[model samples]
Target: MVTDPRPGQILALVGWSGSGKTTLLERVIPLLTARGLIVSTLKHAHHAVDPDQPGKDSYRHRIAGATETMLATRERFVLFREHRSADEPDLALLLSRMAPADLYLAEGFKSAPVAKLEIHRPSLGKPPLWPDWPGIIAVVTDAALPACPLPTLDLADPGAVAGFIATRLGLR
Candidate 1:
């Protein structure tokens, strides 16, 4: 029962820790890519994280006051930018930096106004977020959900979830 999402749609997978958001993405990304869809992912972290290691050339360049560093190889390239201010960039601004893709799957930013699928596990002892989160279009859960406005999918089935996403993105 997936509806057509807007062009270049960005969907968010949101849930509490241990709810299996990342696990689901690992399953879903291949399904979409195998069908010739270019999928990009944006992950938001609440804590400070550095993808570059210390003592690396790129790390040294950044530490020496370089605003940005690009590490390139024949296979792939990575661009790292440093933000010195307290304010963080919004989702739209960050998205503009990414290369063109058919769909952008966001791993966090629960309140960013994008359509989202919430992962819920009863074992986590947390209430369902879709009850309060207006942007949540569906819920993927292990336990049965009460009567909700959004569609619910079983957490054990990644194929079904991937199909749902493909239909929603109009890739089917």
Candidate 2:
């Protein structure tokens, strides 16, 4: 029944702390890209994130009240946006600022208005988010989820996870 994530839309890959979300994404992204998909990612941190070292010129610029700083080189560039308050930007605004891709993959935005693929590991001893969170399209788990209503995917098969996402996004 889940639909909204067509091509060029956002789909979140989310899980509790230490639930292998990053590890699974590390494996799955390559498979999706190998099949000729351009994926962009947005990672939400629960704690403070510092992209620059204290002594770096960009850091000094930010410390001197520069809200945005661009560090560029031949191969790539990085833009750092510094916030002085606790207000976290919403997913839509963050996604809009990113360059277009076939799919926008977000990590750890539990309340965002996007479809999600949940990574669940019962061994981690934490409660699953799917039962309470909305917009979970499927679950990738290492164990049985008898009570879950969504499609259950195997955690060991990153290819299958990639395929599911591709199919859901209508790109496969």
What TM-score goes with each of the models?
0.92, 0.93
Which ranges in model 1 have alpha carbons more than 4 Å from their true place? 1-8
Q: What tens-digit string does per-residue lDDT give for candidate 1 at 30-132?
A: 9888888889999989999898999999999999999989999999999999888898867787788888888889998897878899999988888889889
Q: 41-135 in candidate 2: lDDT tens per residue? A: 88999887787899889889999999899999899999888767779988876765678688778888889867899999999998988989998
Task: Name the lDDT value of residue 138 in candidate 1.
Answer: 86
Pairs of colliding residues, candidate 1: none
At residue 79, give the lDDT of candidate 2.
88
RMSD of 2: 2.6
lDDT of each: 0.86, 0.85
Model 1, position 108, has a per-residue lDDT of 85
Total colliding residue pairs, candidate 1? 0
Q: What value of lDDT does candidate 2 attain over all alpha carbons?
A: 0.85
Q: What's the C-alpha lDDT at position 102 in model 1?
A: 86
